[model samples]
Target: MPYTVTIGREREMAEVRALLERRGDRLISLVGPGGIGKSRLAIEIAHASADLFPDGRYFLPLEGVFEPGLLLPTIAYVLGIRDNGEAALEERIARALAGRRVLLVLDNFEQIVEAAPLLVRLFDVAPEATFLVTSRTVLRIRGERVYEVDALPVPDEAARGGERAMRSAAVALFVDRAQAVKPGFALTDENAAAVADICRALDGMPLAIELAAAKMRVLTPQAIAQRLEQSLPLLTAAARDVPERHRTMRAAIEWSVSLLPDEQRALLEDLGVFARQFSLEAVEALGAGRAWDGQALDGIAALVDGSLVKQTEIGGRPVLSLLAVVREYALGRLREHGEAGRMRAAHAGHYSALVARVAPGLRGAGQGDAVVELGMELPNLRAAVRHLVHIGRLDDAGDFAWRLLVYWWIAGFFGEVRVWMLELLGKDQPITPHTRAVAWFFALWSELWQRPTEEVVAGLGECVRLFGESGDRDAAAMATAARATARLQLPLPDLATAERELAEAVEELHELGNAWAEAITEVSRGRLAWLHGRTDDAQARFDRATEVAEASGDLFTLSVAGNHQARLQLVRGEVDAAEAGCVRTLLVSIRLHFEEGIAYGLEGLCAVAAARGDGERAGMLAAAADAIRQRVGVFDAEAFTVHTPQLDAMREAAPAAVAAGERRGAELTVAEAIAIALPDEERDRIAPALAQW
Candidate 1:
């Protein structure tokens, strides 16, 4: 048996055993695509069916064999049958198993499929011997029962829940492999969806999943999911024991592609234009002007049969997509052939037009459906933006960014959009003044919580001036509110200027009927009020912000206001109310995938714990907040300063408890931290499994 634990093959194992037990089924072949665990499953079946072959069991790997004539010699070598110059190799091997119940396992027979006919000669000589073979292609000889091995079962939407995700075979295998590299790694609520996404993105192939999980030694599951856009280079193995072909995902995929015909190979590379799933009509559009001789349907069927392109159904229509690893390999071929630029342009143009049609629904009554629709197409959308920016289509890129603003904000993709905007602005090309201003505003908005130096404040001021001159009153007002907030955070706070600008911006936004902008500006007003020590005024501002956010369906802003209000509650000695508010905010933030909001929620809960004199809990929550802040590369110096006194007091009162708590919390995932922060009754009711961690 292999050293690594085998995951989830109960059905295949039972079927293989039943076939082997049948009177005529003496030779059983396990067939599947490369890296689909055909070899691993064969080993498992052989180990489990040991009792039937009590005389002898032998394993031979034929991966290095290239000529058909060398098959008998290789088998005789493995069985330790020497050429004594008296009998032929095959006759000697047959004599060794003539009258005994023996089992022979042949691994990696695809490299020498021509030698498959030799298996019948040995079976004819030995009456009671059973042969088990693993190959990517089926051996269509007599008495050979083929067992098709598929990829592990991946988690779907319903199985994305923390506990249900763990039960999925793909996710379980990833966790098991990840633990082999980083022993402390575990699947938790915070990373369950990302882990499931990783499994699905790899198409649940065992070798690919193992290659991805090995990255846990340096990257988080969320980070791995994000980096999978170019997964080939990131998913490589350094272990010396594994075979060379299995050491990298690309190597394994390339081996399979090497076996395809020239025309089918070209079709596979051409299909790389699609970033994700595509219908038959979509693929036909890609082949419209190409010089391929065969039909697109025929080529797709060949690739599907070869396991290079997977065919699935969505909404009663068949769709096709390449596994992330295979797609990356195909894309490399596209780039090598100099067709990537042309194909990428067509892909970008199609998605850009599609987003234009869907932009309006993002803010209308069909917002929920729109969000789900856009989420499913996020990869294609991202690819389009990158292509546009790369080709210096600045105006189009800016238009696309602005059109998807609401979706980006709601889906917690502010950082990604910020990078795209910065890249677009970096190109020294002419763009509309309004486009430039909007780009600058978004690029600066993502870093609003960082220490606002003079340079940052100056940039925001420029955005405000350009927005006003461009005749966009709503944008101008939003920029003004942002500039005010940054000005207040300066080394020497400009209270007079901040207060005046915020009032004007809020009044203008409200008059313009922009509920989302109004609500966000109101939160800034509350922060200013808090600085002025007018606690009642601050509470009223936050209440108004929350009310407007709820009415406008802005959960991100609602979480922001809730966390601020919870901080005030802690200051008022209302620990229970503060704790409840923090829990509510955390739940909303988790749903939105808003990391910054989650960090704030943790900080607020830390204050509540400190007020209750639970120093350990307070220290743990504070450390977890720090971890999130560090990962996202965001820091609020002012907020950290405000919490310093409470943290210092906890440390001074119970140094040992605080230190131990910090150690434990530094190891917690967001889900684990939330588990500890939840109220006792609720934590026990909802996440009893995580309590121990």
Candidate 2:
């Protein structure tokens, strides 16, 4: 009997064996970088795990289809379910899989995160079905075991000819490869080092090693290894006739890219201008070069098929994402088309304006995109910043500087946003007044949430000075207002100075007869008044602000003033009034899909519910508020959702809160916290004061 050729990865092989033996979880993911032998390893593991799975093994390789929505249908098709899409495919598939100990290997799934949840749900229902998925990243669902595949090992030069301690994934690959090329090429000391270097340089990723092995016929091991570092594009297939998908990284991307149409291909290239990920809105705006009408979703579908653009399931919505490598390819195309430099400038201008308008909306006292929309647009917005810097639009770059603070603070994009922002903005720029001012303020605001108080103060001071020279009076006033509030809340800025700037801004707001500006100015004034123990004065100012906001009919100002009112109510012990304000705000925010509005609503509702000792209610509201946190996309502060956590948290919390306790956490106070917590319409309907203490 011919012994089975156990390819590279003794360790991974053993782990897969162990996982199969346990058979605890229904789904297992074989995840790693491209060409890391995920498919081969999966096959071996599947065969080995055969005994554990008494049912038949079925394989569904999603090589061409990138639409994650099609995952279930694929599975249903493989299972031989007649009329899988007719009516009860899910039910039929579930029933068919109920008792069968089936092993379903889902290959190349990273590009389809949206579909993973469907499989997860199915596995939950069908306990006997075992799913083995191969992806670059884990299929992020509950109870999914991840088995990461390392690149095939290349043994040391000196130890090459020895007994197979060459048990490394690299060594196994080298031996298997060299033998195929020269037929008798031994794993000698001289060639081992060369092979090992190749594997190591290739990040020990399987696809790279295999590709290197194929080139062994023409070039020496050393030359092949060195060449791999430079020519990844030229290296195509593996020496071994494994699955076509396992050939080369370029092949994989090409397979995915070929799926797009002319329009999508052009769009994908243009989209690469963004160094950071972006949202659909960003795509629809600056990123979209070719106009895609509603019916033209097919062109987008083509790109989705090519795997050039991958969709992310953000809070149950599909948002597109591009891998770094894909981004690189698109960028080259952008330059080829001579459209790269131009789009970058456009992106900077649009987002700069976008950030400014969206920043004030963070108060949740306004009209804006829904949380879902925000989550979907995160990648595009991030791309916007990159495009700006690459194209030399530094002055407006300030808008992003302070504007993204809400994302870092209230929205919870700290980890992702911080790294991207720091790197993108850290470049050398000749500081203009506008650029310096916006930078100082935004950076300071973000730092206050992420770092020390003193550093934030330092940045704020720089902003205050720059704003007067470069920014408009409106920006100065807003900065002044935020600065003054910070003084009252924290001990960094001079309270007296903060108060003076705010006072001056208030005077200016009245002079301009700008209701929205007046509301913002009063909001700042109210915060100061509260800080200075002028509670009554703060309430009067806040009340006036709310009236003006309503009269102006501007959603943004109304929401901001509402938060102030709710905060006041919490302080004054008017639980009912505060709760009502938040609820109103919540409704308005939901309609607008405003993440900030949702945050305020949840925070406020949690407080009111908790005060009434409704733990379930409080938890629900707090959870709802928490939902909006950590979202990516346009709402990096909530003007968009492509990445906001608001919906996800709400999905988890709302159902439970709908059932009971009123738990809003320590993030906000009973009243002021409540205002910070609740909805715009509610804030508008119920005045914070005179609702009874």
Candidate 3:
């Protein structure tokens, strides 16, 4: 299940399940207003009746589908049916589900209601297929069964007078969720009326009640109830044309938000610029040099207390987030106050600073924590980029995207970042030379080994020139190294030219005192030397790169050089040394959360195992690497090409055992993969150290 249902949606779940399970009711729709729990209820029903479908219960999210024509293709994608453009998509879908009892759950279908009629045709062609949908509006198609999901039941005024009110489904859910945040919360005589009143004020909407209950950690139920009376009505009067249910939801959010002091309110609105989880430090950066002071921490606490913000723990550190509903409301308030632009600027600036801060840490001892922390912030980083782009801050957007080039490559977000970069570049706006240079560099990195060699070469040329013009000697050298690497990858390889370029890049980086970039350039030189059959020279470069990176505390560069060094040792039959280096590199990769590093490290171990005739272990490790690569959206083609001989040898030696090992590896999660790659003693020793950051 991708999402969890609310505690009190049980009855609604049962009813929805009955509709979905009922024969001939192929198009059953869960209908409700925004924040009325329709999607959660539908998901619950789909999950509960998973076995009843037998073939598969495919959930297709249509929120991102803006064009109605893309609807069928999206469904085909979820069904794993590729469209060859030769046949009608509907026909292909019907043929695929011909004899299978598949359940197609089209979620957020309201956004693409124009495509609703297509479902009728689908049902007509495939009687065994069932369509389970969630939408705010009814499909209005023939035989469509609409299960109108409503707000959770709230106690009447009379029921609010006694203990019976505490048992109301809405009140029960509120208490349950509240206890999750603040344990010992209950419907005692001292707070029972307050709880009941709060639930009723929000009209028993599940999202509203949950948001309100989250406040119980700090505010008394009576205070919450009283605050709601003020904020909800103010918005209701201002937005009369909106649907009553939506207005109520907005009111509930506004009421909670209104309880915050001025500093807290400003912080909440500013934080709303984020579309995903953010760190405390990131929020503080937003408040830096502002009127927001030491009280900013108190502001965050207040927002969390009011349930306008949600707090979560990642890697033992607290992360804060806002629910989509609450975020939308906050954004509305932010825009209304004319603070949207300034706050978004702050958001982008903070993430840019974050990228620069973490970029250095990506190489050293605490690299794992740095990776985890940066990975956690990726969503917010992306959100900041999108916000900047949305507001026509193309220069800022490009700069923001450029700062994440290393991160996107390491974290396997190149495809996503590439899309963002292309969109930004496509915009009809003037771009500053520095931002353009950064954008081009990002494009070059993303297109590495993925794009045509000529395109990659051109992008690198432009990137290097722009970086030089921008007076960033370190960045220019990095770009020079990339161009040299690309030059060797060209159709007619230029080994001489690549060596010349690599030498110049190293010199430039060293002169600029950018040890990190210099180490990176050195690693490239090492790889080039190895390719040219200069094994001893390659080893020296790798060793030098490792030393520089270690001194600079740059884990990414060290991992690169270390992995290559381990491969060298393996080829030279230094089995113990190779294995030890691989383990250490794997640990660094895991800590840094660098997927490519982890994959390459695993592959290095695979090579060692294959060389030692340990085909089974080789296969398992290869499978683990493959899984990590697939998850991270990366493919280290160079590593694959280099290891083909070894992997083939292992497969040929023990084909069946290799197959079983691969299966075992496929089942391993990232943590499990780490555990399998490292010995028990090594893992135990690293465990406490890994958590330190």
Each prediction's whole-model lDDT (CA):
0.75, 0.59, 0.75
After superposition, candidate 1 runs with Cα above 4 Å error = 1-270, 276-302, 310-346, 353-378, 390-392, 406-419, 446-451, 635-643, 680-693
**lDDT, candidate 2, 224-284, per-residue tens:** 6665655544444431343333445554344334434566667777767654345566566
lDDT over C-alpha atoms for residue 490 of model 1: 81
> Which regions of candidate 2 deviate over 4 angstroms?
1-31, 35-247, 251-328, 332-366, 370-374, 400-425, 447-458, 492-494, 509-517, 552-579, 585-693
Query: Number of clashing residue pairs in every model?
Result: 0, 88, 7
lDDT of 3 at 300: 82
Clashing pairs in 3: 363-554, 363-555, 363-556, 364-554, 364-555, 368-591, 368-592
> What lDDT, from 0 to 1, does candidate 2 have?
0.59
State residue 393's C-alpha deviation in candidate 2, in Å: 3.2
- lDDT tens readout by residue for model 3, 490-579: 777788989999999999888888787789889889888988889889989999998998897778887888898888877777878988
What TM-scores do the predictions have? 0.55, 0.51, 0.75
